[model samples]
Target: MKLFAVIGDPIVHSKSPRMHNNALQVLMKNAVYTRYHLKDNAKLKEIVNFFNGVNITIPFKEEAFKIADFKDKSVVDIGCANTLLNKNNKIYAYNTDYLGFLKAIDNFCNIKNALILGAGGTARALAFALKIKNIQVTISNRSSNRLKHLSDYECCLYSNLNLHKKFDLVINTTSAGLHDTDLPCNEIILKNIFSNARYAFDVIYGKNTPFLNLAKKYNLKTKDGLDMLLWQGVFAFELFLDCKKTKEIFKAMEIALKLP
Candidate 1:
């Protein structure tokens, strides 16, 4: 049997094990998937040697990229990675989050400008995904610390958001409501931006977060990160299989993600 898991802080809410194990059963892959609460990102390098692969989340994606011995261009381009594969005692990194985000918003129309709220790894992946589409992106974070690595985009602190400016898409990339009732930003700020936005998206899945619910009140087309998780998991699963691509795998994973 092989071992695989997702690593992150506050990982109790993750549905990834349920999402992956079902698909593994369908594929008859002799592997088990689970979650690990990694309070310290630096511990990742010391741990992954035992697992066949691991999916990274939250504050660790950038660190994942930095620690990998080998990297795919996606990770190289974004300086972030959500998937890691171990082979021949070497670690390889990839950024399926960018691909996942692209597939999630594939149907969204006329998205020329986007406002991303957060400055972490997931936010970094999303900004890169939107950049390739030639779309304008403005990243707003509570602090300017992590925003420096994302200098390629128009960056600002939450206090400096142009209250009157509009965007075709507004995304909540913060972990604000993932485990609590808190919204990603001030209610007034969300209202000002969401009111002028055509779409609202939250990176938190499995719940109707205050951010999404508030966007609903404004009649903005909204989506959570469930689809993003499914797609990224699928891509990571493929990498786990060493690229033994098949449509059956996608179907199996899709069915698994729909479970409650």
Candidate 2:
């Protein structure tokens, strides 16, 4: 059987195995999906050699892109990758996160300006996605150092968020609210940022995160990362099978996620 897995730190909470395994069963593909709890990117080379294809999460997307022999345009643009395929003894990288984010926010609102909270791989993907849609993007992080890599976009320290400038959309790409009640930015900063925002999106799924909750309190349309996860997983599955039957595979994965 061909082997597939998602590699990340603190991966015990990931639902990717269940999501991909169900699609494999429905398609009758001879493959098994699993998880690898890697604490750091140092072991990435060794792990990539062991799996035929892999999905990257959290801190490893940038590392994955660095190690791949080839990268798709999306991965090249974002400087990060979330999907990889091993072919002819070479690893190829792709960034399905961009596609997923685009699909998740489609037709949601007319967002002319967006604020992305965080400067990680996911943030890069989102920034690129928004830029292609002609949406002005401003990225904010706790420190200014991480923002340097994403110099293409307007960036600022969390302490210097442009309160006077109104943002139509605000997105939290950090993991701050994934395991705790912490908000990505200070509550005061968030309050000011959301004052003129029309919608908020948090890239942490399954639970109502504090970021989303705060947006809700402000009467802003809020969305968790569930749809982004589903769509990204679907796109990754297409790469794994190299097939076009995405509609059926998407349905099977959706059912798997909904089941107890």
Candidate 3:
């Protein structure tokens, strides 16, 4: 069977196997998807040698970008790599977060101005993607300290949102709302933000996060992380699957994700 996996430190929480393997089975493809809890970057070379392809997360995204023998310039510009494919003994990197992210937004209405929460690697790629589309980005977080190291784009704080300034889109790239106790923002501010947003996108796919639920309550179009996850996984799988088997793999993924 062809093999694939997603790598991260806290990989145990990943549902990628269920998602990807299900897709493979639905498409009648012979493949297995698993998760790897990599201890550190020291074993990156070994890891790459073993897997035909891998989905990277968090800390390893940057490392993947460095070790990749080939990469999309947009991903390179962001200094991160979430998807890696090994072909001809060379590593190829790409950033599906932006593409997947944009796709998730397509599920909603138009997005012109956006407010992104967080300033991490994914945030950087997302911001650049937005820039390419010529959309104005208003970044928000608890602190602006990290902004000094990132872009000089307009930055705001969750506590200081202009009650009058409305945005076309709101995205949550932060780890907030990942756990049961996590919420995207304070109740009052979240209400105000969603009141004006046409759509909301939360990068967390595990469940219906507070960020998404709140948007729903406000009657704004909202999407979970699943579509983004599926699109990115499908894109990453293409790096490994041949022309004939490619179609089957993604077909299977659709079935898996839609399964009850």
Candidate 4:
């Protein structure tokens, strides 16, 4: 059988296997999906060659781009990648995070400005993607180091954030609440931002995080990462199978998400 997996440092919680395996089953493709708790970047570069396709996640997305023999233009521009394909012993990289993110928030047509939390590769991909759509982007990371990478856009240290500022969209690209109850920033700050924000998005799925809870308190439209994860998996499915995400596969994957 053809093999596929998503590799990340903290990958035990990933639902990619459940989602992708269901799609493959519905399509009757001879492939299986799994998750890998990656501990080494050098190891990833070597192992991806043995798989038909690979999905990458946090902390490794940028490193994945660096080692790929080929990459999509978006990956080159953003300096990150979340999908990889092995064809004829060569590795190709692509970014489905931005595509999935945009699709997840497609209903909001008037997003003029956005505030992104975190400064990892996912943040970089999202910041650049938003700029291309003519949306103003502001990125905030607690530290100054990662914030420097997106110098072209407005960058702010978490302590320097203006509570009164209003943004149409606020996104959490960090893993702050993924395994815990920590908010990305000060709770009062998030509450202030959410009050003036029209929509809120947190990249952590499977539970209602403290970040989303605060957004709800302000009556803002909020979403967890489920939609983004699902659609990105769909895009990766297309790449893996070398075919379109038919209506059947899409619905099948959606149904799988509701199962245990």
Best by the TM-score measure = 2
Residue pairs with backbone atoms closer than 3 Å in model 2 (clashes): none
Q: How many residue pairs clash per model?
A: 0, 0, 3, 0
TM-scores for the candidates: 0.95, 0.98, 0.86, 0.96
RMSD of candidates 1 onward, in order: 1.5, 0.9, 2.6, 1.3
Residue 13 lDDT (model 3): 79
What Cα-based lDDT does every candidate model obtain? 0.87, 0.92, 0.79, 0.88
Please rank every candidate by TM-score, starting with the best.
2, 4, 1, 3
- Candidate 1 yields a Cα-based lDDT of 0.87
Q: Estimate, for each residue in 134-224, the C-alpha lDDT of model 3 and write its tens digit.
A: 8888888788776665664787777777756788888888888878667767878878878888888888885888788888999988777
Query: What are the per-residue Cα lDDT tens digits for candidate 2 across 1-260?
Result: 99999999889999999999999999999999999999869889789889999999988999999999999988998999999999999999999998989988986777899999999999999999999999999999999888989989999999998788999999999988976679998999999888888999999999999999989988999898888998999999999889779899889889999999
Ranking by lDDT: 2, 4, 1, 3
- Worst lDDT window (10 residues) for model 3? 238-247
Clash list (residue pairs), candidate 4: none
Q: How many residue pairs in model 2 have overlapping backbones?
A: 0
List, residue by residue over 96-185, the lDDT tens digit for candidate 1.
888888989988998999999998888888999999999999999998888888879999988899989989899989888765679877
Model 4: residue 109 alpha-carbon error in angstroms: 3.4
